[model samples]
Target: MKKQMKILDAQDKELMTVRKIEREGNALIIRGKIFGAMPMVAKLTPAEARAAFSLLDMKTILFLLSFLFRR
Candidate 1:
């Protein structure tokens, strides 16, 4: 699956543009550009992914779930 999205700040300013996100083996790869110019790439392993997600509070998780279950 291919998804192109723009990450915006609270003021609606574009912070980053996500060009692609994909899974490679057990890792998640994110390719994007910061400030619409600088190239950035991140690879998150399963352990790292879990650890990162663990930082989310219950309220945030519920808010995210709302989007997931949206029609």
Candidate 2:
């Protein structure tokens, strides 16, 4: 069995498929298409994802957020 996850854009379109994801490892590798066209591959580390993505709540996520803001 192959473990995979779908990555969707803001408009709900399929952006990419996360074919291989190892959070505890050094990098997260993805294989999919762009704009439903050309094939593409990307590598992102945990550190990069944490700094660039605000929606991620991964293992080492920095919770700079405060509860007071969630009203």
User: How close to the true structure is residue 53 of candidate 1, measured as C-alpha lDDT?
Assistant: 96
TM-score of each: 0.78, 0.43
Specify the poorest-scoring 10-residue window by lDDT in model 1. 62-71
Question: In candidate 1, which residue pairs get closer than 3 Å at backbone N, Cα or C atoms, i.e. clash?
Answer: none
Candidate 1 whole-model C-alpha lDDT, 0 to 1 = 0.91
Question: Residue-wise lDDT of candidate 2 within 1-71, one digit each (tens)?
Answer: 77766779899988776566444468887676666677777888878878787766664344445534656
Error of 1 at 24 (Å): 1.7
Best TM-score among the predictions, by candidate number = 1
Error of 2 at 14 (Å): 3.2
Clashes of 1: 0
Q: What residue runs in model 2 are displaced by over 4 Å at the alpha carbon? A: 1-4, 22-25, 53-71
* C-alpha root-mean-square deviation, each candidate: 2.7, 7.4
